[model samples]
Structure formats: structure tokens, C-alpha cells
Target: MRDNIILACQTCKHRNYTSTKNKKTLPQKLELKKYCPFCREHTLHKETK
Candidate 1:
């Protein structure tokens, strides 16, 4: 099934975006470097519960 997840900024702890992933395929939380307007720089974003 498809699961909805939120990507939050690691530094500012802001919810930046939302994306969906297949639960059966990716059972782990997602992480990536994304641009944050609040931080004004690229930061590591982690999946939020």
C-alpha cells in the first residue's frame, strides 16, 4: 500500500514537503538533502511520524 510521509528540516524542524512511498518496498524512514527556505540553505531532511 501507499503511505504518506512528511519531510522535515533537521535543523529548523519545519515540515517542508509531503510525499508518498510504497510501504512494502521502503519500510524505512526517508532522508535526503533538500533546500529549506527557512534555513536559507540545503539541509538534511528526515521523515516524520
Candidate 2:
């Protein structure tokens, strides 16, 4: 099933985005290059617990 998850900016350590994922299919944590307003640039966002 799809589960809600929070994405945090790696550069500034700020929570920036929210998304969903299929936990059963993809067990690994999510990671994406997203724009962070705090950092004012595109940064690596990782899923947080």
C-alpha cells in the first residue's frame, strides 16, 4: 500500500516536501533532487522517519 512520507532537505536539514510511496514494492527510503526555499537551490531530499 501507499504510505505518506516526509522529505527533508539535506543541505539545510529542513522539512520541505511531502509525498507517498509504495512501501511493499520499494522498501528503501526515498530520495530526490528538489528545490528547497530555505537553501534557495535544488538539493537532495531524503525520506525521514
Candidate 3:
């Protein structure tokens, strides 16, 4: 099982990948600083709490 999951950037949906190695604290890095490779921008991802 994973700690959390979410779908961000409806425009470039499923354009990025998230693995078990990608981990971060809530309301901080994980929720605020998700760098979207497709969009080439840092978008706020809604972490499923």
C-alpha cells in the first residue's frame, strides 16, 4: 500500500509518474511542490489524506 495518491493538472492528466520512491511531508512538499514535467511548472497537487 501507498501513503497517499492524487491526480493533478487535468490538462496534462496522467502525463507524469509517481513511484514509491517519491515521498514527502503533507501540506508541504508533497501537497505544494509537485513539479509537473509535462506542464513544466510547479503545480499544487491535492494529496489524498
Candidate 4:
């Protein structure tokens, strides 16, 4: 099943995005390069618990 997760900016520790993932298929956390308004740049966003 798919689970909802929050993505936070690695550089500024700001919660910027939300997404869903399949926990059965992928066990590891999700990471992506996304735009952060707080930082005013594209930064690495990691899944937050």
C-alpha cells in the first residue's frame, strides 16, 4: 500500500513537500532535488518521519 510522507529540506530543515510511496516495494526513504522557498534555491529534500 502507499503511505503518505513529508519531504523536508536538508539544508534548512524546512518541511516543503508531501508525497506518497509504496512501502512494500521501497523500504528506504525518498530523496529528491526540489525547490525550497526558504532557501531560495534547489536543494536536496529527504523524507521525514
Candidate 5:
């Protein structure tokens, strides 16, 4: 099954579509500095609860 997850940018309200099948999983945890197209820069983000 395809997994659809939401990745929200902490810097701006930029939401990215991430698929578990396509995205690279970090060994430790999610990366802080992610590419944010809305902010036009690399911003930080945390997983939504």
C-alpha cells in the first residue's frame, strides 16, 4: 500500500507530500533543515502529532 504522509515546514506553512516508498528515511530522526518551497529556503520542521 502507498503511504501518504504530511511534512509541514516549521519556518513557513509549506506542506510537502512524502511517500514512505519514495522518501529516504533518516537513521536517527527526521532532519531539521528541509527544503521549503513556500519559504524559498531550507527551513526546520517537526513531525505532527
Candidate 6:
């Protein structure tokens, strides 16, 4: 099943995005490059509780 997760900006430490992933297929935390309005640039986003 798909599980909800929060994506936090690495630079500004802002929780800017929310997404889901297949828990069975990928067990590791998700990391992505996404836009952060607070930082006003694209930054590395890491998964958090």
C-alpha cells in the first residue's frame, strides 16, 4: 500500500511537500530535489516524520 510521507527542505529545514510511496517496494526514506518557496530555490528534500 501507499503510505503518506513528509518532505523537508535540506537547506531551510522547511517541510514544504507531502507525498506517498509504496512501502513494500521501497523501505528506505525518500529523498528528492524539489522547489522550496521559503528558500526560493530548488533544494534536496528528505523524508521526515
Per-prediction backbone clash count: 0, 0, 0, 0, 0, 0
Instruction: Flag regions of model 4 displaced more than 4 Å.
Output: none
In model 4, the clashing pairs are none
| lDDT of each residue in 1-49, candidate 5, tens digit only | 4345566788775666353433355433344568777778788765442
**Candidate 5 TM-score, C-alpha based:** 0.50
Q: What lDDT does candidate 4 reach at residue 28? A: 96
Candidate that scores best on lDDT: 4
Order of models, best lDDT first: 4, 2, 6, 1, 5, 3
- lDDT of every predicted structure (CA atoms): 0.95, 0.96, 0.51, 0.98, 0.58, 0.96
* lDDT against true structure, model 2: 0.96
Q: Worst lDDT window (10 residues) for model 4?
A: 23-32
Clashing pairs in model 5, backbone N/Cα/C closer than 3 A? none
| lDDT value, candidate 1, whole model | 0.95
**Cα RMSD (angstroms) for every candidate in the order listed:** 0.6, 0.5, 5.4, 0.4, 4.4, 0.6
lDDT of 6 by residue, 1-49 (tens): 8999999999999999999999899999999999999999999999999
Residues forming the 10-long window of minimal summed lDDT in candidate 3 = 18-27
Local error of candidate 3 at 27, Å? Answer: 12
Q: Decide which is better by TM-score, 2 or 4.
A: 4
lDDT of 4 by residue, 3-35 (tens): 999999999999999999999998999999999
Segments in model 6 whose C-alpha atoms lie over 4 Å from true places: none
Error of 6 at 48 (Å): 0.4
Model 3's alpha-carbon lDDT is 0.51
Candidate 1 residue lDDT tens string, 1-49: 8989999999999999899999899988999899999999999999998
Candidate 5, residue 28: CA error in Å? 11
**Candidate structures ordered by TM-score, highest first:** 4, 2, 6, 1, 5, 3
Per residue, candidate 2 scores C-alpha lDDT tens digits across 1-49 of: 8999999999999998999999999999999999999999999999997
Give the per-residue lDDT digits (tens) of candidate 3, residues 1-49: 3454554654466435443314543334343457787788887554432
- What TM-score does structure 1 among the candidates reach? 0.93
lDDT (0-100) at residue 24 of candidate 3?
45
